[model samples]
Target chain A: AQSVTQPDIHITVSEGASLELRCNYSYGATPYLFWYVQSPGQGLQLLLKYFSGDTLVQGIKGFEAEFKRSQSSFNLRKPSVHWSDAAEYFCAVGPLRAGNMLTFGGGTRLMVKP
Target chain B: DTAVSQTPKYLVTQMGNDKSIKCEQNLGHDTMYWYKQDSKKFLKIMFSYNNKELIINETVPNRFSPKSPDKAHLNLHINSLELGDSAVYFCASSQSNEQFFGPGTRLTVL
Candidate 1:
């Protein structure tokens, strides 16, 4: 079975500092990868997705993720972080077109430090 | 307008009581889904419906049942809810791949 792993359970970064969230996936074939952010008491918002083509994919909220096939990793990156960026981040991997059912990783809670 | 909306954003009930979460999507998408987010913030897919047909049913408990009245509505009914069912439930809709999610309904079972 396919699965997603987010190693960092919690990450604290200073405001304006660069941020990176690591995501690894175990799948038999090329996978569909996604990053979602959930604010307190709110639904999750899609940050970025990696399907095919360019290894680097840009997403909303000034975020980007790189898909490394060999590494089996799709890590989210932002050049500068803001206080509002603090939230629970989830990484998911699943079928690209079928039911689009996704298996999500244990979320990484991001805390912004002033 | 809300693309995906869920009724009763906050539900509090007893352990043995039953509850239902209603979801509607105005996006006119054929696929809808139900997801559970545990206290620790871990999320898992519970059920999915496409055009009023059951498409994906995860290994969720039988007490948790899902019904799709039409392409736009998917409702989850939990019978004899347990304390462990206290978590945030999210409804989502998809057209092709990208899914739009609702604000989420937080259920509290005391």
Candidate 2:
């Protein structure tokens, strides 16, 4: 079955430190991958997406992700962690065909330390 | 201006009651979808509509029905709500690959 996995249920990083959140996907064909973040009491906002070309995709809030086909991974990375960066991050694989549906991972909660 | 919006940001109702959540997208997208987030924060797709036509329907229960009046509007109606039905419902629309999501509706069953 097609699925997305976020191994870390929770992560902590000190302010000004670099951070990386892992994501893995299981799919039969070339998949469309996406990263989204949700703050407390807020809706999810699209951080970035990987469709076709350019394995390394840049996103808002200084976030980026690289799509590694061999490992079936599309991990999100940030050079510096900020207090505001602490939130729930989700990785998703979608639409396999059409209809714009998405299958999301369980999500990883980020807790930033001072 | 909000690209995607949902009404009744919070809904609290007793079990066995029927309720509906409305979603609208101003992005001029042709595809719309409904997703459910459980207490565990696991998000799952429940339905998808393209051009107001049902395209994908997951293993959702019959009590949960989605109606799309147009390409930009989709509404979810639930009948005989149960405790397990309590969750956060999110509506999203897509023009191509990237999807825009609404603020989400938090439903609580008593």
lDDT of each: 0.93, 0.94
Candidate 1 A-chain TM-score: 0.97
DockQ of each: 0.74, 0.71
Candidate 1: TM-score?
0.98
Candidate 1 regions off by >4 Å? none
**Per-residue lDDT value at B39 in model 2:** 93
Candidate 2 ranges with C-alpha deviation above 4 Å? none
The alpha-carbon deviation from the true structure for residue A46 of candidate 1, after best TM-score superposition, in angstroms, is 0.5
Model 1, residue pairs in steric clash: none
TM-score of chain A considered alone, across all candidate predictions:
0.97, 0.97
lDDT of 2 by residue, A5-25 (tens): 999999999999999999999
- Candidate 1's docking class is medium
Error of 2 at B56 (Å): 1.0
lDDT of 2 at B57: 93
RMSD of each: 0.9, 1.0
